[model samples]
Every structure is written in C-alpha cells, then in structure tokens.
Target: LNEIADHDDEGAALQWLRRNRRAKLWISPVTLAEVLEGAEDVDAVRAYLSRYGWQGIHRIQAETAARLQRRTKHRLGENDAWQAAVAECMKARVVGHDDAFKRLAAGYEDYRP
Candidate 1:
C-alpha cells in the first residue's frame, strides 16, 4: 500500500500489521514511487514504514506496458495503469482506498494489498 492507500482510518494498515504481527508482504514499484517521491516527508514516511516487512517488486517492463495499453484500451490512465502493472508484475495486490482504483480493480482479480 502507498501513502494514499493508508488514508483509511488514518493508517489502519500499519495498525493492523502491528496488532496482527504479520510480516513479509509484497509491494509494487508504483507504490514505492509514491513512497519515495510523493510523500509529504520522506524521512517520516520511511520511519513509519520501517515497522513493516515491506518487500518491493519492480513493475512490468515497457513491453508489458504497451501490451497492457493494447489489452485494456479502457483509458485507465498511465499512472493508475502503471500502478496496476506493478501490482500485477509483483503478483501483489493493489491496496488503496481511492474509490477510482477500487472501482477499477473490481472488474479484475486483485487483492487489497
């Protein structure tokens, strides 16, 4: 999950992790991009995420992107589709609270990440 994904209950994912003691999870490069580049404060975000066992995976390559473009043809947009591609590549779920993303994923098979 990215920063936007955690807006649910003001960081509920982390809270859930802390409570359940779960470890070793999948992550996507798109999510990581948000983590490293789009955060309000990188240090604080990193510190907060340090509590979890975050295993990041790279996104699908360019051909995959182009292939996805040809496949979807649904105007999912670059950023969102990139995120989905990363999730798909990692075989991880795209965890997010964004209504749009949720709606997009509803038509496909995915985890909440």
Candidate 2:
C-alpha cells in the first residue's frame, strides 16, 4: 500500500494480487508494522490492513522464524524472517519484490510484478 500510494512500480504486485481472484492474500503483523512505520495516517493504514488476512506471530512462528534465521547463511531483517515463517506456516506464496526472500523462494512462490 505504501508503494502503491507512492506510485512505485512494485505497486503492480498489489494490482496483480487483487486481480487474481483465486489467490488469498495474507500479511504478518510484522509486515503491518513495516507498512505503518512512516505513515502519516496510521489509523487509515490500520483500517486498511484489517480488511486483509492477518497472520499473527505466535510462539511457534517466532520459534520457526528464529530457527530459520539461524539456519540460513543469508542475512535478513527480523520482520522478513517473521514473514517467511508466516509464509511457511500458512503454506502460502509470498508476493513482494524484496530480495531478502530469495533464499526461501524454493519453499514458497515469490511473486514480483
């Protein structure tokens, strides 16, 4: 949404997701924080996220993310690791342009538009 609001080309990913009726969109709570990090209207963003599927970080997911981070040789941010964990838990594909997810690409589909 931040990308879409800012008119980034990567915003096309969001468009593609919306157009794909067969796809189910999901986001981690960490992702919500990342999206709201620099937003001027936090309430609006919060409301927006509420409309989509939210994957909350639980003890299992936290542990999974930690294990994944420890096992991987590649460097990744905390939130990225959490998102990857969420993806693994949901057995769903990740849609984004972040290169940090390359390592997990084989486990889950990584869509960039």
Candidate 3:
C-alpha cells in the first residue's frame, strides 16, 4: 500500500490489489506480523489493517496452513505457507512477486502485477 501510495516502481501490485478490492480478501496472521514488524508507525499499520479489514486466524486456518507447509513440493517459509493457506481457504488468488509465492503459483493463480 505504501508503495502504491508513493507511486513506487512496485505500485503495480498495489494497483492490482485496489482493482480487486471487492474480492473477499484474506490476510494471514503471519503476513500481518511480517508487515507490522517492519513498520515504523503503529498508527499507520492500524489504519492499513482497518482499510483492508483482515480476517483473523482460526484454529482451522492454522491447521490448514500447517498441512500446506507439510504437503507442498516447494520449501516455503512460515509466512508464505500461512498466506497460501489463507488464500486457499478463501478461494482467492495470491498476489505477490516473491519466489516462494511464485513456486506455489502452480496451485494458486498468480496475480502477476
């Protein structure tokens, strides 16, 4: 979002996200944690969270994420696995450019922005 807000080179991803705003988007707790850890302002993070309206992680989601980690042919990090699980559970596409996500793109649609 900051990239989009600042009109950065990587703003294409944020633009895609905005275009799909009406879609039932779901962000994993792991993803949120990753973002918050790097964020300098708590208020900005809170505002972003409110804007996106993230779905909280439940036991079922966590279990499914764990299963995905164990079953994937690619070696995925904790955050990527959880993000993939959330996307799978929601039947949504994974919008990212990370190699880990790209590796899992075969199973999920890659919103190449």
Candidate 4:
C-alpha cells in the first residue's frame, strides 16, 4: 500500500515493482483496507491496486494470524499479524518497510528507501 502511495518513483518499492514486473504480485484484504483508509482518492488507489491479484483471508490465515500474535506475545499488531499470515499462507514474501515484520518468522522483503 505504502509503495503504491509513495510518489517517489525511484523508491525501493517502486524499483522492486519494476525489477519483478513478471512476478505474480498479490494484495491481501488487510492491505486493501489499509490502502483505502485515509486515502485522498479512493477510486484512483483502488484502480491502481486492481492490477494485483487479491488474496482473501480464510480460516487457515485467520488461525495463522492468531498463532503469530500469540507467539509474538501480542507484540505484533493485528493488521501486521494478518499480513504476515496471508504471506505465510500463500508462500509469498511480505514486501514493505515495516520493521515489525522482523518479529514474525515469515518470508519478508524489506523495501525501505
């Protein structure tokens, strides 16, 4: 979400997008909600995000999120846990600038710039 919202085309996230244009990108429901919240142009953001594949949260992801929160002693925020869970369930990497992702034992790609 932050990547798409970032105006810096030279940022790490944008660079990652360019580098892996052929890769199958995905967005979770948690991400969609986060992107929509406080967005100045909801329609524009939604349209841009529509390019990525949507990954819905299921029972497995929910359970995984709960487990992640418990394992982290509730240090992980609810949304972060869900994001990690979705990545885990899909066997995908969590790409973002959030340091909180380091606490979870999931595949992560830090796109900090």
Residue 82, candidate 3: how far off, in angstroms?
1.1
Candidate 1 Cα errors over 4 Å, as ranges: 1-12, 15-23, 36-38, 50-59, 103-113
- Highest TM-score: give the candidate number: 4
**Model 2 Cα lDDT, one tens digit per residue, 5-87:** 34454566666766786877787878787888867777877776777887788998888888998996775788788888888
All models: lDDT?
Answer: 0.55, 0.75, 0.67, 0.80
Worst lDDT window (10 residues) for model 1?
Answer: 103-112
lDDT of 1 by residue, 4-79 (tens): 3344444655555555465355554555676777666666666656654554434344555566677754655676
After aligning candidate 3 to the native by TM-score, how far in Å is the CA of 64 from where it should be? 1.6
Q: RMSD of candidate 3 to the true fold?
A: 3.0
Lowest lDDT sum, 10 consecutive residues, model 2, at: 3-12
Tens-digit lDDT track for model 4 on 3-113? 456544577777878887887889988888998885777787898998889899999999998887776554778898899989999888888888888765458878654
Against the true structure, what is each candidate's TM-score?
A: 0.55, 0.81, 0.72, 0.86
Model 4 worst lDDT run, 10 consecutive residues: 1-10
In terms of TM-score, how similar is model 1 to the real structure? 0.55
Q: TM-score for model 4?
A: 0.86
Score candidate 1 by lDDT: 0.55
The regions of model 2 sitting more than 4 angstroms off are 4-10, 108-110
